[model samples]
Target chain A: MENKVLMKGNEAIAEAAIRAGCRHYFGYPITPQTELAAYMAKRMPKINGTFLQAESEIAAINMVYGVAGTGKRVMTSSSSPGISLKQEGISYIAGSDLPCLIVNVQRGGPGLGGIQPSQSDYFQATKGGGHGDYHLIVLAPSSVQEMADLTALGFDLADKYRMPAMLLADGTIGQMMEPVVLAEEKEISKVNKPWAVTGTEMKREHNIINSLYLAPDELEQKNFERYEKYKVVEENEARYESFMMEDAEYCVVAFGIAARVSKNAVVAARKQGIKVGLIRPITLWPFPKKAIADAASKVKGFLSVELSTGQMIEDIKLAENCKVPVELCCRVGGMIMSPDEVLGSIKKLMGGAK
Target chain B: MTTEILIAGFGGQGILFAGKFLANKGLLEGRNLSWLPSYGPEMRGGTANCSVVLSDDPIGSPIVTNPDVLIVMNLPSLDKYENAVKTGGTIFVDSTLIKRKVNRTDVNVCYIPATALAQQNDMPTLANMIMIGKVIGECQVVKMDGMEDAVNKIVSARHAALKEINLKALKIGNDYKE
Candidate 1:
């Protein structure tokens, strides 16, 4: 029987990783996301898994790098500032073509901004925060159920593409509680990684996994190869959900917690005689441009709702190729956008009647 | 049907727990639900609140701007959330803690006096359940059986001894007159 429980988003994500055969978890404590590490610390040992609390975020991510090198399912999570610290390591993981899971339970930020929900890391997660020509398969989950499901998906996609995948969530989603049915416990050998650096005694030669190359052309060729993999991911892995969009004249594009809130606003707007709908991007790195372009052809305009000022608006406009004006509705620095505010924006777009 | 509830009070008043109870009951009934708590440094010494949504259809926004039912256990919570209840909605106030009379006549106001009742019963921390009882009795937002199931799931084994008392407190509030 499947396990169903009422869980916080953070706890569910941790348990999902465990169920997905992720035995090694290394992380440092941070607000709004501390429960995740705490759950791992308590459960991993009981499951005969390894759970380590590193001295710093930098060390934890590097620990993930070490474990991922062994071809074991491994992951680390942190909030905004801590993620900033892990960027260098994340880039190295991407460059080395290693597979692993990274979770960013985002909080309001520029620097030490606040321990509240925010999506300010869109650019960082999608455009590559770590300084490199690479992308993380960014999955934005809107609910606790998605938190669990997407964590498993992140691992699968990471292994499939040999790249890092991120579960990009916000503080609200992390801290929120909802019912989630955890996936069945998966066997450890879901992927047979051939390039893992196990002891060389049984093999013909020792496998070496690294991101460094002595020759510039060698590094450039490696970059091109990684990009080729990324192109395949972009083509096949872009995921999104469209709601009430079949007859929509205007669409609200959002993700994670913002998407959850915008859904309410869309329902309310529809009841008030406005033909509004929602387009929720599940994969932020691939950006779901095709979905946006499709909606642009049918909708009168678009509204980009986010917990940040306007980070995702750029992606939305680019996806639509500036075919229609994409309006911005947002709340930043720990404040969340309310349904009334979003409905107000839709009403204004419909000439301020409803 | 959709019900949005906001429960607010001082940090130790189990305000978040009450919201959790409702959210769990909703989930147990196979309804769509969400419970969003306000997290920040204010959690240590300031007021705490949580928003709960129970809907027959898929819930869109978990953030409740105007709640169908507002439960405030302190004067500050009452002052902060009084205007956020929808017109003709219900507002449950802990009258023992909130001395100020509610000014709005547009909504249905039930002064539960949950704190005094819990103190009288020698269960000072059970006020939230009393308020929950009153909410369930007045609104019938969830089935009593669902609440019972939720209580069993939410109360850990370490606190198993307190379950009966909590249930009794809920009964007291449910049987509350006026």
Candidate 2:
């Protein structure tokens, strides 16, 4: 067994990014995710990296945009409200087709809701937070281990696809500490970036990186090309975890902390002779639609458990094409549903079926 | 077996630190464990708590809504979580700070003068460790054999000298009578 070190989820993401050859980190401090920035501030200088605390979240994301244009791995992290401030820059980055990592260690919010963990930012993240038609590859990590693993994966996927990737995590996973075996640091074989804005020095045509396409025909052409890339991502990048779905009669859809809670409920419900299971989506954007669609033909009902009012339920409904009955079990305003509460929902599904 | 432990007290009373030490000890024993602190806009004297889970199987939820072992340093914590413990679970209290007794009859309750013991032992800031010591001593959720190593891992090198005193406080609480 490899040596496992216990770490908070926020710290794990920072360390993994460093190991993934991300040397430029720019962010403003926010609650629940301040530790990631603090870790970068401490480690970046020692390793000859750039760690700048920008004046605002807007400035921080623009800095990410600037570094990304140069083709060096770069990232910025913030909680929900701060993320809201960075949406314009995010849209700009996506519009320019630049690759970078953006982390939203989400907190409860409509307007500075609370500093506690929440998954209410689901629509803003998956449906495009910044406006204009674009999707940032979104990865949801349920554990401290995935928090590290997905940071590395997010950077790779973003670079491979030439777009921004978002690690959409909530405050609980960001604050929780669990044992994680980090990948051994290896030499990073970076992808070739012929499109990078490295100065030509009169050798060739000057490379230009810009998002402005004032001509309607040109802008429409760009959008069509980006959607083609998104189509490839949707087919190849969708990821999820299926627990006890082999013989399940009911299905529970959740992600991140809510999934962890639902897993416990599934186990307990099984012991009580309820054949329920869980489908935890690892990538929120390229959602595991096929998994839910397959389960729809078999399961009696679907329960969407969330820390938000009811966000992911819509996706589950669309995935199954409403073939199975879908219901919502949720809490909001910084409240998390307990395992027993989820168990009750599972039992209710069973009772309704009978 | 899985043990869900909830330790609650004020922000600066080492509530989260004690949870981290127990979690590190569980890791040393090769048990799956998670430590989730209750983080918010909390100041030094504000309410603070953390949930620690150690299990032989893979852990599911990091949150411990119904703790098998509850440790409270202040009255507010006890008031908030006293009834949330499992039917046969144990509740450890710091008698020096919380003057009230456990109101529930179904659960086992042990009241130790942890703050008093820490102050008397000249480790004024270690009441949380003393409470944890009593928890492990009575419940035996984790053995005491690997505790020294756990402390070494949790306390950073800059605070190396404080490690010995922390172990001493644990020993005092572990061996305390009544």
Candidate 3:
């Protein structure tokens, strides 16, 4: 009894969070992701949830921190520029080991780039966007269904690790409509937040949630502990999808919408008897290294198709051990790469390698 | 077996709904599917479009650059996407809007009078549904029954009463032997 419903990725995410037991949403209206805020504004009141349109992205993220500090499920979202505004707040929340979901429906950037979908925030999302020694568990969703499912997972992982997690989607996925089989949500138990400062009575002592460890040794221990947690995440949370990778000679490495287009490109290439395949990373931070590395033995080379000035190319290069050459098909600034363009790149790589 | 399609037209022409219907039929048929759209400032009283990919395997990219099928509801969309149709692919143009035929000989062209059919049925709003039916008929990407289910699923929330008209529109076009 799977019931399919067609919905935009942004609205789907808002509804999914509600189903996932989120009681509070704090955010600003940013293009390519405004539907989420609008959905929240319309639905939050009905569910007795607080949907606060904060004056700035900074204010919005801090509101999320305050709500999450109370041990309630909470979230915030924005596009790339707005996300940049919230970075400092993101760092503080991460430093305090708060459990919250931050959704970034990324658009082109470096500055106020454009509203078109782009994956330019890869490095910023995975490798710490703010000033600090911290990391956010980044989940890359390639479709509207994932947009809903991953927002739920984002909250779950955040609560599990007692750190902030991010749903790193792009504008294309956000605005798109698709038939999504919305899953039945898991129950949210009254969570344990011993770190919360609800107030200290005469019987209990005062509690503190701070990231300021002035002592270098204490800070180092916290950093090391975070690294240990990240290692656990890398081991257990690395996710990717493979398409016809078994017994294939050529593979394309892509994420988000680029992955979707490459899927078609690979199919077209395969129809031409080229034996092409694809590897899609769902978790960009963990890098899906094991999967990509495993691909090296089966495929001659990996084609890194991205919507940037070749940002994810660095990750592809790092994942391989000189066993296979990684090629780049880069596009940026609100420009979408055609499947033929990707196939052309693949053909070039295959011609040179074979 | 993957079937990728692009549904393009004006903002009010039901292009997004058409793509969603195609993707819904994929779901009904137990296939992996995806429906991706293009919208923003450009959708305000302007042209809009979406790419819907239906396949037996897990759909990789939903953004279709070169689609196996392109359903053009208007002229701008035909111009925007005519070159992107795969060689030997099928192009379904609304005879009401696109007066000239697609000149390419490598692909098959379906000249369905979607607007004409809608107006003749006295239900002008179902033109997009007519186009969807034409897409299903010409491409056979999804079954008509499956498309009916898709329509029910798509229109249930907002326009439940409009389903019958849409289904009738589909039956008219799907039954058209042309």
Candidate 4:
């Protein structure tokens, strides 16, 4: 706490990524996330790291793919439309089982939407943005401190699971400044990557990193093996935060900025004698299903608050197995739901439950 | 206690900088705080605003929809956010730039000729600092003791001279009357 400094969430993510031993950064300019690339552009050179502003989002993700093949921690970031452009490379990287970080400081978008905070990319990020059955370990940070912590965590998770990880943030968190106690600078020891395409030195079989499989059965076996790894990740790595859930009758489920807003509403509702709490999912891909399922037994209903038109509500419903009534409170097209608006929703949920 | 402050002005009026300064003061005091700016094409040459929340407890939403303290440096901002302040909240207006009187009678309003004061003090760009000084003096959200330290933390070493001028402007606004 003594060493806390005020930093924008985007800058915190960049600094934490550097601290996490990421040496290669490839990105194109995009609003709400441009500060991240600008930070990397300024710092990467002094540290002798690679910072390339690729010609396009596709080029940037492919650059991430190349560096990831070398088994080094590399990352790229963008807003919504740009993130859509990187999906193809993301699928390829996942197919190769490469470890890397991807950051989406999302803005409003179906296509070229306004540059305002939005979580409309929730489905795209959590349910596979690219083709093929693959998952990115998605981490959502609701605050600037989490922004830094999750960037480091994303790299570690990616390395552990041998897959790509994402920091799914929004424009509000990306642009906001807050006090953050950054992780201390420690000696970063490289993780042993035997599958890395570093030269073999003629001592062992050559290592090949590729997504292309000519044989259908070989690809099927590879997909099966990857799913096995994913199963372990889902079991062990699902993370969430429960707030004021003790003795609560109604629950609000949200992530990223929506979770922050929902927290306020929960507090207000509690003041008004409504036993409502919050469940904030930190890992979106491994959606915190267990938490919802467990809370379903106690809570009367669940309110899914989001910055999109009720995208994460489906996940909440599925998680709770439709045992309890689930409702959606949301705003779309880069608009955020105010705390009062969310409080109104919470009160409505309470009334409907009665 | 939580104080949500909304500062609005023209793009180059140092609205974000003032909010950052206030956020840093809260940070230095070890209080939980968040500073969020309205970022977009409008920031090029149009209205800009920032929301700063300083709190003793953990802050939930960073956005300040109904601010406890509202500071408007221009007329449009005053017109837009005048009704958005909490009923018992305070509004600080830069009278030098905005000529209209506040219409709301439910909230406390302070009109400071911040730009004129900054000009008379030979620091024209220090108007934002002046308004911030008034905010600190009136709201008492942050103490005046660690201002020098806060300025040192925000201003880079290369612009060391700004520390002196900014402090002077803050003192001017803090001591301003009528």
DockQ of 2: 0.92
- Model 2 residue B87 CA deviation in Å: 1.0
For each predicted model, how many residue pairs clash, with residues at least 3 apart or on different chains?
0, 0, 3, 0
Residue-level lDDT tens digits of model 1 in A1-354:
344578999999999999998999999999989999999999999999999999999999999999999989999999999999999999999988899999999998999888988999998999999987999999999999999999999999999889999999999899998879988897864687878888888656879989889899999999999889889998999999989999999999999988988888898888888888999999998989999999989888899999888999999998999777778899999898888899888777666222
The 0-to-1 C-alpha lDDT of every candidate, in the order given, reads: 0.90, 0.94, 0.86, 0.94
Mind giving the per-residue lDDT tens digits that candidate 1 earns over B8-62?
9898889888888888788778888889888776564589999998989877778
Report the backbone clash tally of model 2. Answer: 0
Interface RMSD of each: 1.2, 0.6, 2.3, 0.4
- How many backbone overlaps does candidate 4 show? 0
DockQ, 0 to 1 scale, candidate 4: 0.94
DockQ values per model: 0.76, 0.92, 0.50, 0.94
TM-scores for candidates 1 onward, in order = 0.97, 0.99, 0.89, 0.98
Ranking the candidates on lDDT from highest down gives: 2, 4, 1, 3
C-alpha displacement of A252 in model 4, angstroms? 0.1
Instruction: Supply fnat for every model shown.
Output: 0.76, 0.90, 0.68, 0.93
| Residue B27 accuracy (lDDT) in model 1 | 74
Predicted candidate 3 versus true structure: per-residue lDDT over A146-225, tens digit per residue: 99998888888888888899888988889877668786866885567787778777668877778899999999999999
Supply candidate 1's per-residue lDDT for A263.
Answer: 89
- Model 3 clash pairs? A260-B60, A260-B61, A261-B61
Q: Residue A53 in model 2: shift from native, Å?
A: 0.3
